[model samples]
Target: MANYKETAKEVVKLTGGKGNITNAWHCVTRLRFNLKDKNIPDLEKIKKVPGVMGAQFSGDQFQVIIGNTVVDVFEEVEELLGGTGTGEASSNEKEGIISKLMDGISGVFTPIIPALAGTGLLKGFLALAVLTGILDTTSGLYQILNNLSDSVFYFMPFFLAVSSARKFKTSEYLALAVAGTMMYPTFLDIAKTAFMDPSVVNMTIFEVIPIPYVNYSNSVIPIIFSVILLKHVHKWVRSWMPKSLSLMFTPMITLVIVIPVALTVLGPIGSYAGEYVGKGMTWLFDTIGPLGGVVLGATFPLLVMTGMHYSLVPIAFSNRAVLGYENMIGPVNGCTNIAQAGAAFGVAVRTKNKEMRQVAISSGISALLGITEPAMYGVNVKLKRPFYYSLAGGAIAAGAAIFFNCRSFGGGGMPGLMSLPAYVHVEDSMNVVWMAVCLAIAFFSTFILTITLGFQEDAAEEVIAEAAEKKAIKNGTKHRVFAPISGKLQLLSSVNDNTFASELVGKGIAIQPDNGEVVAPISGVVSVLPDTQHAIGIVGDDGVEILVHIGIDTVKLNGEHFDFKVNKGDHIEKGQLLGTFDFEGIIAAGLDPITMVVVTNSSDFVEIMNANDEGIIFKEEELLIVL
Candidate 1:
């Protein structure tokens, strides 16, 4: 695998460096960067990076697709950016209300997906276990597992509090405090009693002012709005509060005001809004039937593309909470996901590009498992016709879903092939059968359609004068970089760090040094010499940028046992000494002395080839060819 750290650096570098980023966060598969200048990064080069599956601009977010390892890569990127990860985005950029809303919804909902998906899947399986007679609903284990799966959804406001706090840039604990008020034991008991008996209505705040006893559990908008209110309230309270007493009194005063405002006004408003929206969707779904399914299913891919899909996520939750089941929106989303996966598989079979085939197959499987961004952007959208065909498949499958009345009883996970059990109706086992049939239709129909109506794929490495390019390989106009240190030459992949090994920064080779001598790889000016004295960057006369890092992670030593002969901008020739490190000392410190010599600008060239394979070599031996 390409080293994640290096891939991260390359990702950060190609996104116009850390300075260009205003905010950085991630979703299931992509590293999302809210950039200061969206046009700065080279999207094409980012896609070519070894670990990046794809890249694109969605509004102000420059999304780098890293597949399943996105969290790992995002962590590395966070380290590179220091503590500025997820800082407040620049408020100056003008975006439509929908765009901002989508961004906000995505930010708030993304972090909770793992909890939701896991619990949701478990909920489905528990139903299966019961349906198969392996476990009884009355059994102790079944109840415990069932409640455990239900916990996230039952107390959803708390999760939203934390996530929305991060998005709105407020205190998470404070937000949780507000959610606590909404879900307080007293408040819950009163709301239950009031619901059970209509006469037991209002809970009074101050004798004259009555706060309605509304159940805020399983709620969405209330906590989010409370947090947004908290952010402003916290700031205002802190503005003039005495620094000495601020910590204690500020939270107290802030909460005293915010919670009452939330309980008395905001909570009721959000609660009613959620109910209306959920009821409205259910009514529309019941009334329109197949047309409702068709519209939602076909447009889902587009919603996902623009991140507008998240705008409906809150409504789905509300639907599950209020209506007790959803047969309208989410199942259609699952159908689209399956359809995309099917189309991706078709593209995998038909596309002659080896790289496309690799991406298609991997992305197809990911989409099948419920993550569709890879297949959607990497395969379907890129191939054009497959995306439309997949939509058609999704529309048909969704119509079938509604026509058959396939339903999701309980759970909060993405609808997909693995989540078929989510449709397990305790009262009607046929729901599962119908759900499976719908998904199968989505897969097979899209697969058949994609293969039958093939896309325009690039011809197999067509006559680029391959023979001629090979014959002109020795031309002086091409660039050559000599070995920088003496030892056993090895492929970059042999190095421990993935960044160099994966060639994500650029194509290069590694050298396991026998001695400490480091020399100029090409005759040009020294471009970068770090204060740490562990690496050197040189620009060759032919414009090939070469970076020779002395040892893996040797920068941690703070320049100890290392020396450089040339400063930045100094002239250098092939084999001329640039620096030296204590190879034995780095080894004693448990750091590898395997140096990586890379062409940092490898993307600008057609090919970057190593001069020789693994063997002992001197600093004077040819190391790389750029053509």
Candidate 2:
């Protein structure tokens, strides 16, 4: 992995800096920015960042593809820029109703996905253990594991409340209060008692009004409705309340009025709405037979691409709560996800273009893990033909799902193999068997179709030439890398750090410093200079990325005895002073004083080899040869 902090800094700078970012957020695989002016940012520079996968404009949002490490990079970017962007992006200008609604729901749910996915996996594993008799259901370990798995879902309303508050730009504490009240022990007890004995429920609140007793556990829609209502109501109250007493009375009055209203009106309304949606889905499936599945499966990606997919999220949750299983979502989702992977794999196999092939293969693997945006945007949709192949595959697999009556036993963030246990019906083993079959069919059908129908052909030579030009190097291209410090040259393997010794950070040679000064190894732009000042990243004009580490684990010194002479993005020629470090101080701190000069982008070249005999070397001497 690349240093995420460095990547974050570069991304922010490339996107017109912190000043230009009006708002920023991230999803599973991309950093999304709402810029003051999109044209001011150099999108090309953002795309060229070492770890970045791709960049594009999606509607009003400028998206940077950072693969799976987006969340970490997002946090670092936020910290580096001291934050830019507001959560009030819901009021985006001229956005369609569906687009805004989808954006809002996605914004609310995206942050919650990690917890949901983690617990979902644990839940699935627990179920498997019990089913296979590896874990006794009555055992203490089982009880502990079961609660660990179920805690997230059981208190889902609380999580949703917090996330929805941000989406609506409301007080998170107030939203959480609503959720807490709904799930309070007193409320849960009353609701449960009422369900067991309907006569005990107080049907008449004031002898004329009717109120329903309902448990809000594992529910989604009610809290969202309540919080959104709270935002507007809280604002109205604040507008009229006395300024001196506003803080005290505002929350008091808002809670007193909003809690009852939400329980009596909004909460029930959401439940009824959920019931109707569940009924509508059932009616569609029942009335149209397998045709409904085929249509939904085939059209799922289009819905996702248009940002309309979030509309189905609540329905899936509602189905699990009301029907104990979701027939409308899980089965088709499995097929669609697998189909996306298969289509991308097909592209990888059929495309002669090296870049496209690499992207397709990598994104295809991500799709299989339930993250499909990379595959969908980076490969299938880009190629056009592969997307159609995926749709065809999804349709066929979903038909099989309908025939088998496949369903999900629970609801969570994303649907794929990780959530397969959600489809397992203990009473009917066929559910698991058929779900697996559906995935297999989707993968194979899409793969075969994409291979057969192939993408529109580009001139083979032209495709190869384009890739070569982008890399800025041919098979025989050579570049010289000079020693960045006067030191004893040594094999990279002789370094104490495994990251350097194993060549995972990249192919490189190491040096035992005789002095403290480090210089530029080649004429290049400084790409990254981290805060600790222990390492520097230089992007050579020849496209090689060189990293010079001052000493092993010297970052722990916290710049105590080190000083960097150059800042990020500065241009420097070979032998120019880049930094000075304390070699003896590092040894006194019990750290290895070995310096590493690595070709971080060595894979882009045909060969990168040590040029000098391992011994004393001076700055400006030939150190490495790249071809």
Candidate 3:
């Protein structure tokens, strides 16, 4: 993997230097850049660069997809930019209502994904063990497995503490301290005593009291609230403590003060608030009856897409608290998954593209198995029709569930076949029938809708044909290499950004300029000319697209001192003067001009060879190895 510094330097060079960069941030797997000039960087070149999955511009943000390793990449990029390693940007821009809501939901859930997946796998294994009679419920093995399953639920506070701290940019230790207070042994003892005899303790510290030794194991709200309090307490203590002693006294004093406040006031308040929120959701369903289910089911898929499904988790936990079973959410989640599977099935049946069909089938199966990212991102997002079909199916299932008065009887978050026992209401024979009906509705609605609205053969065939043609072109030929710039030679891999320096995109060498003039690297036709004149793309005779981007974030300068030397679609030769840049002027304007030559059609070559070493290079010097 490319280190962070290398990635940032490359991005800086690609963007036309620091002057063109407005702001940068990252989310999950993408580096998002906001540029002053919309077009200074050569995006095609960046895309072809190694370590880059793709580049996309959406919602006024230029997003560079770096896959799962984006965080490390972002860290390196930040160091190169002379900023703190924190991934967040200091921007006052207010997000839209929808965006804010989505952010809030993601904030709450993203951190917990690993824990959830791990615990879920453990539970699945336990079920398998019992089903296969590997261990009796009374055996030590069964006991150990049960403890493992229960540990995750009990220590959720510790898990949330870490995730929330990262999200809030607070001291992780402080967050842990707060969680510890909530789950403290002393406090639990006091609570237990109080619950056993409420009248014995008259002088409450904060006009509130603990529920005397009630086990808060598997609790969520108390930890969340305590951490929120910890944020303020940590800030206060850090600010007040003397610099020399801060490393120790700050956390110690903060914990002392915050723990009491949490135990006496925040804990009870948070617990009650969570209870109310859950009750409110149940109340809404009760009042609206089947319509509520219909509405939630219909829109749940959209909520998931926008990453808002997490807001409903509190409700599920609350359901378990109040009724000893998770009723409203698990069934709905199962139905939603079914709906996604339905959509993928639809796409598979409709598309003629072999790749698309294969992706759809695989994603659809994953969705059915309760993992939906692949289907959602790779299929539904690409083809909009399947998404709507799934939504319709979900709505139908929700309606059927509500009409049947189906309710869960167990504590699982999302109900699957194993959780069917949870929804059984012993007194009502109709409960079983209702559960069966809801399941049938969810399954059949998705299956039938998808099959009926499946793919169109013509569209699939066209896509497949285009893919084949591209593949053939990639394999059929080799092309002449070009010198990206006229300067003293530097290895492309030595330029600092591993993505380019590693020649991940294609074989090319970097240049340390003896002077500041850029020439055409190859004999080719100009393809694109950005507005800022910071970048240019040329197609060589060998069918290779080479892109040259100047500096990092120079697009922010809005073409202030940049001068273009050619027009798009113009034919040019190697060593031809393509453009001239005022290196001093660009620096004075606060930009970095580290030019990069990239093969946009990198897949076409079987290999890229770097053929140059240290020396002054005229425009026509053979600087890259391409096979």
Candidate 4:
């Protein structure tokens, strides 16, 4: 793999040297860039770079789809981009109803990926062992593995507590405290007693009067509902308590108020709400029956793209808990994932671009492993055609699933091949049949569609070239100047931070400028100007691209203190007025607008040298080097 630092530097050079990259992190795969500027970076070159698979923009963040080695690459990228890290900001805000709903669902579910994958793998292995007769249910090994697999489900509240705390920006310990209340030994004991003897108990101790006990372990809604209420409880308690005793008294009172409300109302209500939602979904499937599968299959790809599919997890789990079986969503989702893999395989078969072909093949494999983000974001979303093919295949699989009356025997989200054993109930022997049919439809339909569509080799090139050209232009300019706010001018190379000094993936000079209005360093054609108004990209007379990224991932500021002076594609000259900005207002709004003068097209340059020192720089001072 190419050095991650080198690749990151190239990216920064491509971005015109000025991007406020506040934070960087990675998941099992993918290096997520939370850039200050909202402009889409050079995703194409980032993909072409040796270590990267592909790059994509999603959910107000930039995701670089790297495979298993993403962790290693992330370390290198961090080293190159300085080590400063920031917490991921919530994507939720005032938006359209559907958008907000989607954001909430994504936020709630993303943190659970590790648990789901780990448990799924264990379950898959257990099934393999049983099928092979290597282990029997009566064996000690079976007991051990069963416990391992079941622990994730039993202690799900703990997992959800941590994830929900991050999502809600609340104390993780506080969330754990709330989760503990629900899963406390006393609570479970009371629940067990209540189940055995209905009339004996008074109100539960947490409440004024004895109430019926409900088991909260392995439950989803109660904890989430409780945490949501806890946010308000915490906020209200903190406001009134004396400073000295605030910490201790606040949590005590918050719990005193919130816990009872949770047990008395929210817990039961949320549980029923989940149950009803699941039933409603099942009812829709029943009414539609086989046709429902086909409809869902067709739309599943789009739903995944928009991240709406996560909302179905709670419904699936709830149905499985309540009915000991789940119908509809899981089967459809499995089919969708299979269809995605099939489509990617098709691309691999048809495409000649070595890079696209490799990505297609690897992405297909990853999808089969149950991580579809790489395939869905990198290959399917980019190609557009494969996504449609997956939709068609999904519909076919859905039809098969519904025809077979497939039902899940265990609780979970999507049932893959590994979890198939748990889903097989003797009464619903049709599940096996449906599984076969779904697999067949998903695989065959996508395979055939991809062959029919063939690979559009030309399309990939068009996109790739456009992306590369943008990078080249951004990096090619000589002597690019920047406005230093009447303060010390830090050489672009002297910023010491890995992201700036090493030029990993973004470009521009860092300055401790005197606070004032930021103007265009060297005017050119504006390439990108986002709605957030936090940054602008300009292409100069020399075919060099310069991006003036105004602030550090301040897109979240919602355009509060920014004013744009140029439209995309507008032409201007040196020292031209770009726009007026509120440095103090942005800071007051809790944002950092660090202006960077970057050369987006750096590939054409033989060498780059920095000229300005720790002094005030006029608008046209010789600040950068180009050969």
Candidate 5:
């Protein structure tokens, strides 16, 4: 890779420097920036930086694709910037209520995804173990595992209180203390008694004012509202309090004043609000049946595109909390996600663009894991038609799911193929089967629809020139080589090593090898195998010249580390093992171990089109289209 520090500096500069950036966050593959002014950053300049895969603007945030090494790059960038500006402000553009609500929900919940997903996976596994009789409930092991699985959800108010406090800009400890009151033993006991015996008269505050007997365990809205209220109250209290007494008295007065008000006002209001919303949703589903599912599934993709799907997160939890099972959100999420994957797969199969095909396949797998942003932004949305196809497919599958009465007893972090086991009802193994059926329906529907609808071909001059050249070479006219190693594909322009980056070794693609082994890219006679064995030149059929340079500066090792399988003038077929080098040794020697497969005689071809895809490549895979 290029010097990461230099890349960081360039990135910072191109993003209008540190001052222009308000906030910076990253997912697996991209660094998302909230900029003070979107127009200030130069998109093209950022994309041209070595190590950058691509860049784009999405949903009011600017994104820079950094591939797998995003974390390291993010650290470097963060250091260069020192500190960032305050968080995102609401958009001035007129947005629907649904859109605004979803944005707020996403802000509150996105920070806790790691904790949520880990516990959700654990719960899914625990459910599977008990249902299958692998673990008895009476066993000590089961009890410990059960607590581990339940703790997150049982005390969800505390977790949400902290996260929501951050989002609402309130005191975190104060929020937690407030949340604790909702789960206090006395309150829980009173709530439990009221739940079990409707006729019992609950104890009242001062024996005059009645307390709302409601359980806030595993509740969503109560904690969110409580923290939001805390934000305003804390600010008001802090403004007038003396600095010496501010820390102690502000918290004391805020907590003393907020707790009772929360229990008497905010808590009851939020609880009732959640309950009615759940009831309303249940009524809608019951009244409309399959149409409700169809509407949810079809609109889900569009919701996600606008960051509005998060609006359903609380609704799903509320339904589970009030009705003991959620039939709407989980099933529809699974269907929509599967449909996205299916559409991406369809694009992979139908598209002739190798880069598009590669992105489609990888992003499709990510979609199956319930992380559809890659599939959505990288493939389906980019292609246009596939996104619509996915939505249509999701609609049909959701209707089937609704008909089967599929339900999730607990909130799933992400409703995907792996988390389908979470849908298994204790008394019904068939629920899991139904979930699978829905997923299959979604996959097939979108896949078939995408193929039927097709994509508008991108035939830029370079693509057209490359296609014509490939055609000319294929019909008994010419020949080409393949990739020499298994690793991630990179452009020659993106390579870190100076000689390769400068294209002094001619034009071709680079491979960041995962293993030490190297193989012959094609049938060729080794024309120049140096004594050091760090580089090899091959003369393929019809005089196609190729070079395989193993490492950036491995020549200093002087043949000490390389194990050559073939010598100069040896004819090797495609996929033949060339040799293995010590990857660890190269690292120890302080040399970059990125390998380059270049067409040394590039001017000989009408056009040499490197595969534009950025993904893992295997030996003998088509690496370049040399005309």
Candidate 6:
């Protein structure tokens, strides 16, 4: 995690420093910059930044792809920018309307997606509860659960307003006020009455202008369009009004002028636009039927690649708002995700490179859970054939889903196997079941296709060494890490702490020490030996930065029940004494005694392989190989 912060610093420096960036934002997998001088930063140098997966100038923006840790990096960059003397970045480079629209949509939607996805999953679980007969819908707990899930969709306008306001550079509180008006009880109560009563008609404001009963709940486009207008209006009002009056009267006048227009004109325009788009999609699918799904399904990966997939987000939201469910972009997108996951899984099984296999398997799991960027970029796109096979798999899966009446009734933003429960329809209980069948079809079809249709593999998995172990650590000489003091060897993923388990610190093995004894795993200088005596770091002759930590959160013990023989900068030999800790004391202190040995500079190597020690391991045994 700290490595990504350093990555942020490197990225900020590489991208013409803090001053060069005018506007910056992030999507799921990338940090996008609107630079004052886009040409100043070299793409190659940007790509070489430690945490960056890739870098490119996409259309009118400079994009630095950073998987998973993009948010953390974005925050760090923001903090760095704030610490210095700065002004807003201004850019003169012109962009097309389409590019600008895409940027706007991405900026506005990116911040709110996590909320949507989280609540969406909750909604899915609630559906499962209903289906399993575990809870009656009429029960108090179910009632609370239903509204808890509904809150986000019902207040979507507020979320959109905050994000859109920031994108448009307007007052946040005023934007909230506008959202408040849209969801006001006065209007919502009337709209509900109109739905039930036959004689109710459109209400006239000042007995002159008629305002349509547009349900603001679950609405998106209206608030976005409204905020765009608000940006201009706020500026205009501030320019004309007294600066002293601006603190109060300006908002009053702005709301007075904007709310009426929103209800009477802009609201209806956005409302109709969303309705027509929903209707248009319905018509297209109905006329050509399953063929329409085939085209969209096959092209979903390309959409993800070019970052144009976000363009479909609003349409999907709109469809859910207007038509109560969307057949496109939700369940169909999940099928494609499953297909991509399957393709990555196939690559994982086929590739001889351990590193590539690790990446493929992890990315494939992420795809199955609903995020596909890692799988798509790290594995399938690189292999080429897996990507193509995925398209076919997605097409067939989507066609099957549509044919079986699977649709996204919940409108969850993250689509995958986990979200299949969102397809459940009370009137048609088979909806989720059909979607599961389709996703399974996606996985098996693409997996089989990839294996049967093989592609060219990487040139080599193991690095070829030129020289011997006496040379510099950079040389690709075979390196071994012996057991420091082992009991049962466990994968790092099993560690309770995220900092270690996520491999944010580094990658290696965790061990449950049979006794208190600790020894050096490698012959090297003791690079870091903390006073707390819970951890030690060594730099191996093979250029591996090794760290051995005793137990989880043992640092909080403040040197309790610990002793060490080594000091920082002391030269240590392989299997030599380093330290000892009371594992029984640590356990009694309510802490985990799982010791860890990690290669801190793992990315510097071609591959790191385990020496195959599983259970009840002894001391001074070969544990890991570094190449």
Per-model TM-score, in order, reads 0.74, 0.69, 0.60, 0.65, 0.67, 0.72
lDDT of 6 by residue, 474-559 (tens): 64668889989969999888889877887866778889988999988998777666558889888775557789999998999999
The per-candidate count of clashes, in order, stands at 3, 2, 31, 45, 0, 1
Residue pairs in candidate 2 whose N, alpha carbon or C atoms collide under 3 angstroms: 23-85, 409-422
RMSD of each: 16.1, 17.8, 12.4, 11.7, 17.0, 18.5
lDDT of each: 0.84, 0.81, 0.66, 0.68, 0.79, 0.82
Count clashing pairs, candidate 5: 0
Residue 572 lDDT in candidate 6: 78
Kindly provide the TM-score of model 5 when superposed on the true structure, using C-alpha atoms.
0.67
Q: Write the per-residue lDDT of candidate 3 for residues 1-627, one digit (tens) a residue.
A: 466566667776786566665555565555666555656677877775666756765534466766456778878776666642233433455446764444443454555655554554465456545655676778988788667755656676787787667655577878887777667787666666776887655335556653334345556777777777887788888887899999878888888888777766777777777778888988888888878888898898776554457677767776766665555787777667777777887778767677888988987776766556567666875566577777777788877777666765443433444445445443554665677667667656766776776532334234323443544444435556767566677666677666576565555556665556788887767776766887787776556668787765777877776777787657788788877777677778876666677776666678766666777876666767666
**Could you tell me the TM-score of candidate 3?**
0.60
Best by TM-score: 1
Query: Which residue pairs clash within candidate 1?
Result: 3-498, 3-499, 6-499
Alpha-carbon deviation at 428 in model 2, angstroms: 1.9
Q: Which stretches of candidate 3 lie over 4 Å from their true place?
A: 1-88, 95-105, 124-136, 189-203, 206-215, 401-440, 455-627
- 94 in model 5: Cα distance from truth in Å? 10
Q: Once model 4 is optimally superposed onto the true structure by TM-score, how far is the C-alpha of residue 179 displaced, in angstroms?
A: 1.4
Model 5 C-alpha lDDT versus the unseen true structure: 0.79
Q: Quick one: RMSD of model 6?
A: 18.5
**Model 4 C-alpha lDDT per residue in residues 1-627, reported as the tens digit of each score:** 457676656654443232455446555556655555635366556666776666666655566666667766767666666653334443334345664454555566665766765664576467556766788888988898878777767777888887766655567788898888888898788887877888756565635555457887777888887887888789888888999999779888988898778888888788778778878887888887889889888887676554566667788777766775666777777778888888888888887677888988888887765566677777876777787888888888888887777775544533445456555543445565668667767867897898787643443254334544654433344555556233456666765344455565445576654565556666556666776887777666555566666656678877767777766556678777777678778778776555566676655566555675567776556666655
Off by more than 4 A, model 5: 1-100, 199-208, 461-627
Per-residue error at 314 for model 1, in Å? 0.6
